[model samples]
Structure formats: structure tokens, C-alpha cells
Target chain A: MNRTRFLDSSRLTSALFWLSLVGIVTGLYAAFIYAPNEKTMGVVYRIFYFHVPSAWVAFLSFLVVFVGGIMYLRTRERRWDTLALSSAEIGVVFCAIALITGSIWGKPAWGTWWTWEPRLTTTLVLWLIYAAYLMLRRMIEEESQRARVAAVFGIVGFVDVPIVFMSIRWWRTVHPIVFTIDEIRIAPSMLAALLIALVAFTLFYLYLLIQRISLENVGHELEALKQRVA
Target chain B: MDGVKKALWIVWKDVVCELRTKETLSSMFVFALLAIVIFNFAFQLRGDERVGLIAPGVLWVAFTFAGVLGLNRSFIKEKDHGCLEGLMLCPVDRSAIYAGKALGNLAFMLLMEAIALPMFAVFFNLPVLMPSLLLVILLGTVGFAGVGTLFSAISVNTKAREVMLPILFFPVLIPIVIAAVKSTAQIFDGVSFDQSMPWINLMLAFDVIFLVVSFLSFEYVVEG
Candidate 1:
């Protein structure tokens, strides 16, 4: 059983490893080579393929955290808490990636590295919310209590996300519209590239989530072993 | 509902205690005053030209920070005296406890504002005593206090809670702060009430959404 335990985990890890490598290669080819350059923004617009996909998966991670939090509250399941924490940690990473990529895309397209545009501001807030979620988990010492508090926070924080998005959108509309994403009509190739990148990044997010949750489980086991020895 | 009565009882208890000690209110008022003074120096609105331009931002910043100071004390006061356990031991509904605490926090914030607003108006030379501005303050404070109470309860349980509350509080507060600031700015610019209607509605929506969310989720936070 002990020997098989290591083998079992590694088997899934290896499978995900190969799957991600293939998906990433295909995604890059589709985004850069197969997709046509925009008439206006030139090659700089290709960054959207990566930026938007990362943001999509990052948002997806928050949804997972939201659901996991609700489930933990309802059932008091440790697995749910574990999943929430793992996804939130990864969500922060992907959120950072999205923000950085968006900034990189912005420099060439908008002639500025940052703007208080609605989508950008909303994403920044989302990043902050999850970052604080991770901090809340660290500050609490007791296991069950930590899970409980973080779960409550996770659920409550998710509620504000949509409101933040809408309010920012309304704010921009009320004020002068600064930078609009509506102008670029997605050609067939661009649409195909977006789909490919989104699928690839989502699969990658799942791979990372599985690895993170496993690491968390191992940390739990190590702590338990240390307690037993003490 | 008994829950409503129980909740008000909690608020009454807090108010009575605050009235006697005056610790939270005094600190919040002083902190708010200091914040406004700092803003006055920081902005250095050379003359009449820039005073109105940035008065709303300064007012909201001072109020929000001072409100944070009050919120930090709200739950810590309960924890310091070990009153939280006693309250938890009660058979009353948890939502009642949440509503009650939220109301108590809101009252503290409003009281701070009641004093701070006139002072702010005098200091910044803005006409903040108007009815529309008060209404905006009321909606903004409700949303701020609603979410602030829950986070304060959560933060008080952690180390570095004084720091924790703001870290957790500020992000969730973006919409309210933005809406309030925008609405107040428009009102100050002499825009008609109809012109600022959307920002007012934004604040109202945020208040309702957060109030309901906090009310429903407070039980989970306090119990855990």
C-alpha cells in the first residue's frame, strides 16, 4: 500500500505533465501562427489570446473556491476547505499572470501600461480579494477554525465580485469611455485561437490545482506525523 | 420577528456600553479629525480653485479610515472582555447577533460622521451639510458598516487584527467608495439630483447586497 501510494500520485502527475506540454504547444501555435494579425493593433493584439485565457481560468478558480467554500460550510468537510485554499492560491497566481499580461498588452495598444478601465480595475480587485483570502488562511492557527473562517470569507468575498464588475462598468459608461474592446471584431481565426488558448489554459489550471491540493494533503500528513512523534 | 428584537437588543447593549466608556467614539472622532487635518496639509489646495475639486475625496477618505478605526474596536471589545463567548452561549438567533453588531457599528460610524461632517465642511470650505450629501453618507455608511462588521469579527480572531481588518475590508469596499465619491463629487459640482441618480442607485444596490450577504453569512463566521 505504501509503495502504491507514491506510484498512484506520480501516475496522475505524469499524465497531466504530458497533457499540459502538448496542449501548451498547440495553444501557442494557434495563437501566434494560425491567427491573423489585427489591422489596427498589429501583433500586440495577440497578447489578448494569452491574457484573456489566463483571466478566464483565474476567474474559474474563484468559482471553484466559491463553491468549495459553500460546500465546506454546509458539510464541514476538510476536503472542501482544502480545495478552496488550493484553488485560491492558484487563482492568485493566475490573476497575477493575467494582470501582468494585460499590462504588457496595454502598453502597446493603449499607449499606457495601466488604466482605470472597468475590466482592469475589476480584475485588480479580484486579485486583491483572493490575495487577502490567502492571508486570512495563514493568520488563523487552529485547523478547523481556520477552515471555517476562511470558508466564510471565501463565500462572502465572492459575492462582491460581480457587483465590483458591474459598478466599474457603469462608472466607465457614465464617464467618458477611455479604451474600448468593442472595436476589434474577432475574425474566424482569432476566434479559433481564443478557443484553443482558453481550453489549454483551463487544462493547465486543473493540472496546477491537482498538484497544489496534493501538496496540501502531504503537508497535512507531515504535520500529523510530527505530532505523533512528539 | 424575535430575531429583529434580539438584534436590536444587541445594538442596545453595545450603545449603552459605548455611552458609558466612550472609548470607540472618541477614538473614531479624533482619528477622523486627524485624518482630515492630514488631508488638508497633503492636498494643500492653494486657493478656491482646487478646494471643491478634491473635497469629496478628502471627506470620504477621512470618514472611511476613521470608520475602520471604530470597526477594529467593535469586535475586539467583545473579545477583550470575553463577552463573545457569553454572547455565543445565548440561545438567540445568530443573524440577530450579526444585525445587532452591524447596527452598533453603523451607529458608531454615523455618530463619528455627525461630528466629522461639520468639521470637514468648515475645514475644507465645502457645503457638506446638505440633505442630499447626508443621504449619500447614510447609504455608503450602511454598506461599509455591513461588510466591515463581518470582517472585523473575522479579523479580531487573528493576530495583527488591527492591520487585518483594513486589508480585508478595503478591497470589498471599492464599489461603495467609488460610488459615494462620485455621487458626492457630482452633488458638490451643483449637478442636479437627477444627474447623480445613477451613483446614488449604485450605492443603494451595494448597501442592499452586502447587508443581505453579511446577514446570511454572519452565523458561519461567528460560530467558527
Candidate 2:
């Protein structure tokens, strides 16, 4: 908004860009070389490093959208709507990645490319909800109304995720439960590698979210300018 | 006016309109019947022992598809007739409009199911109209109309219009589909009523949650 804040934001973006790059490179090494092969599953278990973080970041981004939706409705701020839209797009991407990686892992681990496991079903439902959010955005022609309706959906869809998980879990769940309250149930090296990947993926998600929000702001300004000229 | 009174008035108006035109019920009923007929053909349901295995799923699928038709008409008619503005202008709470539309949709869905289920039973020779099944149907339809009414309002205003309703409605309605189908199967399996209680509870919970969320966020949807 002001000169110094603008400068600080630019500096922050570049710093995030470089940090994510470095973190991802380090994460790759950690996942591949630092972590020992899993005894039962061997190399197929390597996908877990990326799968867990993508899933985590996907859920994290939806939380951003959910919070943004509430704030947008309360404040009626353009920034909040922009934040929701941007996060939803990123969330969809990461959610898809999580699904694909998990499916690939399922083939080797379970001898099936897909299963109605609780976690898998929840992710798929979340993915469909995200798609609906984006589709809702695309279908509305009016800017403010679009934002309003989308925010409504964002809030409602995020709230439905737990209900979806619970209903499906009650139906069935054979997905491996790796983490518990007390310990993660893995070797220390594997845990360390997972931590690195999680941090790296999280940083990468932040960088993308900031970039997308700024891009949306620019698009809004351009639309305003075009209307004025016309 | 009070919300309930106002909502009932809206429902009264919609039901009268539906009664006069017979438009919404006809489309929904026809679609539902056709779905059952098709299901009968696909699954070969004549005196089959395994009908219980797949019948619940088939019944739910048919009903939900038909319910979407009923929901799509719930708001599209008001908006298309330019009556939505008048409804918005009324001093009543916008949630009155939501509750009214949702109630209207539920009525149409239930009526359609009442006929469709008996026809399905006769054609397939399955005993589907029991008391427990009726309760399951009521719970499922309430959740469908509750959430579907909000989506109906939102979707009818979108670029794709009525086509968007099912895309948005069905995915979020997964819990209802699962719980409803499972409960129906449980009933058919002659399981104890207590065993099916969780599934019934699930539909009841989804009904409450979606209805509250739809009520809270509804004003934003109708406001200009």
C-alpha cells in the first residue's frame, strides 16, 4: 500500500522464492538419500514423503480459503475474496497431486490402483468440492456476486470435509495409519526427511499463494481500467 | 411476519404454482420412473434374490436424480418470472425464501418418490414401501432439499443455469447418498432397527448442518 510496505513485500517474495528453491532441493536429497529404505515396502515408500506434504498443504490451503471466506463475508473486502480464489486454485492442484501420488502408491502397496479407503475417499471428496468452488467462480458473471456466492460455498464445503471423512470412515478404512498421538511410528531418519519435505512444500505453497493473489489484484485493476476506457 | 408464517406463505405460493402447471412434478416423476425402469432392465430385478444387494443403491440414485430436477425448478421459476425481485423486496427475512424454496422442493421430491417407489416395487417385486424405508426417505429428502435448495438458488443464477445444479448438488450430497443407501440396505436386510440407527443419525445430522449453513449464508446469496 505504501512505498516501504510495497518494497518489503517485493523483498519478501524474492526471499520466499529463493528459500523454497533451496528447501525443495534439500528436501529431494533428504527424501531420497537421507532416509533409509522401508523394510516392507522399500522404494515405493518414498512417495510418502511427497504424498503426505501435498495432502497437508492441500488441506492447509483449503483452511486459508475457509477463513478468507468468513472474513470476506464479514468485511466485504476484495482482498479476502482474492485470497480465497487464489488459495482454492492452489488447493485443487495440490489435492490432485496428492491423489495421483497416493493412487500410484496404492498400486504397488495394495495391488490396486484405487481403494475406497477412508483417507482416499476424503481426499477425493475434497477434490470434488474444490472443483465445485472453482466452477462456481467460473459460472458467475458479476464480480461482487461471484465473490459472495463463492465465499458461501467455500465456507460450506470446508465444513463438510469432516462429515465426509466420518461417514466414509464409519463405512470402512483400511488405509494405513502411520502417525499417532505419541509417536510417528517410523525411523528417525524417515521422520527427519518427512519434516524437511513438509517444510519445503509448505514454503512453496506460500510462495504460490502470494503470487496468485497479486495476479488476481492486477486482473481486477485491469478490468476496472477497461470499463473506464469503454 | 414471522419467519415460519412467511416461509409457509412462500411454500403455499410455490405449491399452488406447481399444482396449476404440474410442471415440476411431471418432470421429476417421469425422470424417476424412467430411472427405475432402466434399473429394472439393467439389473434384471424380477424376483431376484440379490435385489437387496443393489436395490438400495439403485433406488437412491433414481430418487436423487429426480430430486435434482425438482430442486432446479425451485428457484429457476422465480428468477425467470422476475418474481425473485418481488420476493427480495418483501420485508421478510431472505431465509424465509430459502426455507420456503427448500420446503417446496422437499414436497415435490416426496410426492414423486411416493409414486415411484410403489411402481418400482410392483415392477421389481421388491417390498420397498415399509415404515422404516419411508423414514429413511424422509430424512434423505430433507437433506437433499435443504442443501439442494441453496444450490438451486445459486445455480439458477449461474451461466450454465439449471445444468449446474446436479454438478454442485451431488458431490456435497455424498454423505446422504451413503447413509441413505446403507440404511435402506440395512432395513431390507432385516437387521435390527438399532443397527441402522447410525446411518439414520447421519442423515439427520447432515440435514441439520446443511440447513443451518444454508440459512446463515442465504442472505448473501439473494442480496444484490
Candidate 3:
């Protein structure tokens, strides 16, 4: 189904809301209780179980913003703009959570709260780009014009994300992150927990996205209704 | 072919206007100089090792911020002076206007860089005037202006535009900035052109990608 009919359904919306809630509670248990403590990094390493998933969702949200933007530019529909705006706002929040959790994990393991690592730098850049996208949207008063401008930006910003990641990856002077999460062999149980967390977060993003888009749609309808009354 | 001609004509128009006033160039040059000098003072680049360490970052910092100053002017003038409406009245494709503005911005940025590179050498007593370094600068500037002109157009219509341009521009330009700085540093370090190939290739790829993207999207940006 197209986004409007799909996201517009009250049944699907509530289902997503309740399902995501259950998934997240289960995910918290998977992250904290089911996953084993690591040998080198110990308890701090558990943050990755959530932190990595948050980053994944943030990236997914920006991709949605990109697709939504392109579709809006093509279709000239308010619904696509709503999708873009809602996704941009949520992406920034998840990006922030990932950065914060990463920092929290970094302090105990890496001995520094922040370092110019590629993933960290790329994520920060992503955050700043989307934050600017939101800022650009807020600053413009004209609705359709705002959509056009913001869509162009949304396309450009997403295109830049991989390049941003690559350039920083090449540019970093330090040795690769000392905590080689790669070298740690994931036991089957840990892998299952990680899988559960990823699925849960993905569900949560969809639920949040549908809710936010509905709220925006209501706001659009309210404005229309107000104009009709006047 | 006609599109290129139209774009070049727009470029010519911008050049003539810029040459008449000397407004954008003078400010860009001076700002770049101040940035270079300030960086020189901040880092105290006496040793070759230290200069190699910090020069790329400082040089790009100067160019990007100064380059942005020029970029901000590219569209703001058309916008503030009501020239944008005039341009829109012309029987031209929006991409032509985009190309014209992008090229015009590129020319001004190169001119400013041409001046600043020598001054950067003098302030820091470094070998800045190498052929390889110039290529890196050109690639970097093309990439910068390619995206910069598009974004400048986008920002001029917004409120507190001065604040918005940098905010919206830099984060997206981070990849280009990193590539430019790294390539420039490698060239300065007496590395072979072959050695800096990866960074050079990165800049080239960025230049190509964004130039095409900005070109395609320019229509939506200007059309109401």
C-alpha cells in the first residue's frame, strides 16, 4: 500500500504502537539480561547492543527522509512532505541517543569521552545535517516552497552521508578504534539478543513514524478547517 | 550547446558585475588572508614538521569560511536586489541559471584562492605554489562551489540567512572539506602525486556527484 493509506489506518497505527511497546520491553531484557558481559570491555560494552541499533534506526530514518523527499518533489503532495519532516525530526533524536550512548560507552573503555573516530565523526555530521534540515524547514513560512527546498536538501544530505563516512574513515590519524567490536566473536545467544534488539528498534521507528505523521496530518487538516471557517 | 552558452552568458554577467564593484572578491581575499594569518599566529609554524601537521587544516578552514562568504553573496544579491525575479523572467532553463551561478562562484573562489595561496606561503614560509597543490585546490573549489551555489540559493530565501548558509552548508560539505584538506596536506608533505591519488580521487568523485545532483535539483529550488 502507498504511504497514506498504509500509515492512515487507525488499526495498523495502534497495532504498531502496542507491538513496538512489547518488542522494546523484550529488547531491554535482551540487551541487559540475555547478553553476556564481555571479557575486555566488560559491562560498558553492553551499550553497543542498544547504541548500534539506535544508529541503525537513525540511518534508516534519514533514508526514509530521502525517499519521502524525492517522492514529494515528484508528486507535489503534502503527505510526502509530512513523511520527510516527521522522519527528519525522529532521525535527529535517535542520532543524538546513539551519540550519547557512544560517549557513555567511550569514557570507561577508550578513556576519552570523545574521539575523532570515523563512525563517531560520520554520525555527528549526520546529526548536524539533519538538524540543519529541520532548521531550514522551520525558517521558511511558505509551505510548498518549504517542501521543495527541504526536499532538495534532504536529497543532498542523504547523498553526502556515505561520502562523509568514507572521507572521515580515510582522514582519521589515529589507529582504528582500539575496541575492535569486530574481533569479539559473538556467541549464538549474544547474536540472538542483538538480532532481537535490531528488530525491536526497527519496529519502534515505524510506530513512531506513523504516530508523528498522523499528528502532522491532523495539524494540516486543522489549518485547512480553520481557513474554511474563516 | 545552447544551454552551455546561456550558462556562460550568465557567468559573464556575474563576472562583469563582480569586476565593476570588486565587492565580493576584495572581501573574500581579505577574509582568507586574515584566516591564514590568524592560523599562522595560532600555530606558530616554525618547524617543517609542525607546518605539515597543521597547514592543511588551517588552509582549508580559511578557504571554506572565506569561500562561504563569497558563496553567500552569490544568491543574496540577486535576492535582495530583486535580480532573481529578473533572471526568472529570462527565457532560460533553471539548470542554466544554476550552472551560471555555480561557475561564477567557482571563478571568484579560484581568484580568491589564487591570491590567498601565495599569502599563505609568505605568512608561514611554506612551499604552497606547487602544480599538484593547485589541482587539489581546483578540485576542492569546484566541489565547494558546486554544492555551495545550490545551497546559497536555498538559503537566501530563508530568514537569518547569514546563519542558515553555514549551518546548512558545512555539515554536508564535511566530506569535501576532509578530502580537500587531506589531499592538500599530502601534496605539501612532498608525497608523490601517486601517493595522494586516493584523496584526489575522493575529491573528484565528490565534485562529480554533487555537481550533477545540484544541477538536477536546481529547478525545484528556484521554481515556486
Best by DockQ: 3
- Who wins the TM-score comparison? 3
How do the residues B1-224 of candidate 3 rate in per-residue lDDT, one tens digit apiece?
88899999999999999999999999999998888778767777664667778888988999999999999999988987788988988999999999999999999999999889887887666888788998999999999999999999999889878889999999999988888888887787787889788889999999999999999999999986
Please give, for residues B1-224, the per-residue lDDT of candidate 1 as tens digits.
98898999899999999999999999999998998788778877543747888888888998999999999999998999789989999999888899899999999999999999988877767787789999999999999999999999999989889999999999999999889988898889998999888888888888888888888888878884
Runs in model 3 lying further than 4 Å from the true structure: A1-6, B47-49
Candidate 2 positional error at A154, Å: 0.8
Q: Which has the higher lDDT value, candidate number 1 or candidate number 3?
A: 3
lDDT of 2 by residue, B1-224 (tens): 59999999989999999999999899998998888888878878766767778888888999999999888878888887689998999989998888888888888899999989888787656888689989999999999989998988889779997778887877799999999988988888898989889889999999999999999898998888
Q: Which residue pairs overlap in candidate 2's backbone?
A: none
Each candidate's interface RMSD (Å, one decimal) is 1.2, 0.8, 0.6
- Taking all chains together, the TM-score of candidate 2 against the true structure is 0.95
lDDT of 3: 0.89
Candidate 3 chain A minimal-lDDT segment of 10 residues: A1-10
The residue pairs that clash in candidate 1, if any, are: none
How many clashes in each candidate? 0, 0, 0
lDDT of 3 by residue, A73-188 (tens): 99988888999999999999999999999899889978999988888888999999999999999999999999999999999999999899888888875365666557766888
